[model samples]
Target: MVDYHLHEAIKEAGLDLTKEQMVVLKKLHDEDGLNQNELAYLTYRDKSSLARLLSKMEKKKFIVRKPSASDKRVNQVFVTSYGKEIFESAKPFVGKLIKRMEHAISETEKQQIISILKKVQTNLS
Candidate 1:
């Protein structure tokens, strides 16, 4: 599956990150200072599960969670300098994987796939 290929690509690129971690890292990098709730929602993870994942990422120094200035109960997540470095390191491999996938499919096929996926999502919702 695509996920398996992506995991291999990341490992072959010498990055010690999982696809889940990369996803979270990219999200945080794209929108720094997102609170835990926002990150959980964006990542499609429940609160407790996201917390555990964040805990591991925090231990890896990929991210830092700070108490919100406005609300003490909320924790804002930010990518550290090291996190940015890791994300930058993984970008090329991800890009290559994307290129390979795109090369394998025509634009029309890609659109059809997307449309079908959207309909599936609608049905699920």
Candidate 2:
């Protein structure tokens, strides 16, 4: 439900990327050069799925994957100049998204929700 709303918001804002792609771009922007495995872990995506996402991003010229200098088999992901611009453009929307969510709940309720989610995660594990 939340994702659907956010997707609509992004579309209305004329952003051509999905929320998932925005997340990957955010991670890369924060940490410029991350290997594929690292990105997958950080984004909670499987390697194959991440590969598909990266392929789309690559085709859009938003990111580039280069073979690691130290490890030929490892591909490091980096945001291109175009990707940075996109990231910047998405910041205002992201900020609004954050603010909207935060404003919907009190701090205490937010903490409680976090605790409940953590317990749920522990149970699943």
Candidate 3:
């Protein structure tokens, strides 16, 4: 339901990105220079699947993969100018969604929820 809401919001806001693609873009925006393997782990995707996704994103000109200076074999991913523009444009919509989702929750409640979710994630890991 949350994903659907976010997808509709992005579309309504005139952004051309699927939720999955947005996840990749957002991650790259937050932390550039992540290699394909690191991105796969961070995004909870398999390496092969991420490679395919990266290929599509490259064709769209949303990202560029350059050979890492430290390791020639590693490809570091970075968002392009177009990708940054799209991410900036979608920021308001993302903020709106977050605000709506947290509407009824107090700060304390929000912290508690975060704590619980972290514990759950740790348990799973």
Candidate 4:
């Protein structure tokens, strides 16, 4: 539901990005030049799926995959200037969604939820 709403919000904002694509864009924005495998791990997506997403993003001019200088076989992903702009534009929508989602939850409850989610993530890892 959250993902669907976020996708709709992006669409309403006149941005052509899915929630998944936004995730990739945000990750690259935070740390550019991440290799395909690294991105796969970070995004919890399989290599094939990530490759497809990257291909689509490349076509959209949101990102570029350059052959790594040290490893020609590895393609490092970087966000384009346009991608950064879109990401920046989407920040407010994301913030709004987060705020709305947490409106009924107190800070202490939010902290506990975070702690529990972290533990669950660790267990899965």
Cα lDDT for residue 30, candidate 2: 90
Q: Which parts of model 4 are misplaced by more than 4 Å? A: none
The local distance difference test score of each candidate is: 0.94, 0.91, 0.91, 0.94
Error of 3 at 3 (Å): 0.7
Which run of 10 residues does model 2 get worst, by summed lDDT? 4-13
TM-score of 4: 0.95
Instruction: Write candidate 1's Cα lDDT for 10-45 as tens digits.
Output: 999998888989999999888999999999999989
Give the CA lDDT, 0 to 100, for residue 96 in model 4.
86
Candidate 4 residue-wise lDDT, 16-120, digit = tens: 888989999989988999999999999999999999999999999999999999999999999999999989999998888889899989999999999999999
**Candidate 2: tens digits of C-alpha lDDT, residues 1-125:** 77887787788778889988999999999998999999999998999999999999999999999999999999999999999998898788777877888886988999999999999988986
Q: How close is every model to the real structure, measured as TM-score?
A: 0.94, 0.91, 0.92, 0.95
Q: Write the per-residue lDDT of candidate 3 for residues 28-125, one digit (tens) a residue.
A: 98898799989999998999999999998889888999999999999999999998888888889989999999998999999999999999999998
What ordering of candidates by TM-score runs from best to worst? 4, 1, 3, 2
lDDT of 4: 0.94
Which stretches of model 2 miss by more than 4 angstroms? none
Give every collision pair in model 4. none
Clashing residue pairs for model 1? none
**Best TM-score goes to which candidate?**
4
